[model samples]
Target: MTLAIPDLPAVLETDRLIIRSPQPGDGPDLFDAVVDALADLRQFPASLPWAMEMPSVDESESFCVAGSESFQARKDFPFLFIDKTSRIVVGAGGLHRPRWTVPAFELGFWGRSSFVGRGLFSEAADALVNFAFASFDAKRVEAICDDLNVRSIRVCERIGMQLEGVLRQERRAPDGSLRNTRIYSKCE
Candidate 1:
């Protein structure tokens, strides 16, 4: 089952990064990151539907505000992966589709193209998974990605998430192609 609490910590830190929830006035920076990563992100249309449009600053801010409210209400927790030293949003990810009865959540993440292959997503995942168990009654945490996304699959493996199996032709890509989904999970 999924669980959340208003008093839960907003920021989670690892050795090299700080993962924090959405805050007000984050639109400009958030918008820039999306704009910078648009090209690469476009390749996976199924990820963030809002991101596919390359939203304006106002739109991005609106998104952040909604996210903040969910976090505050203990609905969902979508966090920003911030580089400790550079203070940039290297990537973002979070636990979603919470099943409170089972205390389970699905993990999703993406990173700036420039920071690709740096293991940032893995670091973020490690922290988020720990946060889930420590902050709530998380019995199982999952990370599912397009089967063809080798990078994301690697992130799952790097974080020690075991591959359950691939769901063949499970999703449709932005290019209108049927894609398989790889389901990975980490259980407590």
Candidate 2:
């Protein structure tokens, strides 16, 4: 279920980071992270479609507005991950509950290339999973990744999500090659 950013306390906090709503000022940071990690991101299904299709800064600004409004309207909860120690906006992630999925939400995340090996996605995902099961009253949370994305698979595993199944040749990448996808799920 899409959530309006609740007035509840911060979504998640670890010894080194805080995950919170993406603010207006984060557009540049978001852009930079995405651009910097384009090559790495292109290898994953979740980001391949957008890795090379960057819009103008003005367009990205508009997107941030829509994202914020959607978040506040209880339609989705997208967050920017911040390195508390350095005050850096290093990545973004989110939970999306489509109306058709009533009690379930899917998790999506990505990080700065430099931050990938530091366990940021794992910590952030664990935090989101907890928030979904606890505060959102979610009964299930799912994460799907390209079959070849080992890093993402590890993150899902670290968060205790069980490998559910595989979708055979579910997607055709930009290169027109078919790709299988792995699905992981956690049920309350």
lDDT of 1 by residue, 66-140 (tens): 889988877888898889999988878889988888789999888888888787888899889888887876999
Per-residue C-alpha lDDT of model 2 across residues 1-188, encoded as one tens digit per residue: 54453464544787777888775766776777776666788776443576657656666566677778877776887877888988777787788763435468889888888888998889888888888877777888899889999899999999899999999889988777889889999988
Each prediction's whole-model lDDT (CA): 0.83, 0.79
Q: After superposition, how far is residue 91 of candidate 2 from its true place, in Å?
A: 0.8
- Residue pairs of candidate 1 with colliding backbone atoms: 1-99, 1-100, 1-102, 1-103, 1-104, 2-99, 2-100
RMSD of each: 2.0, 2.7
Residue 110 error for model 1, in Å? 0.7
lDDT of 2 at 129: 82
Name the lDDT of candidate 2.
Answer: 0.79
User: What is the TM-score of each predicted model, taking all chains together?
Assistant: 0.93, 0.89
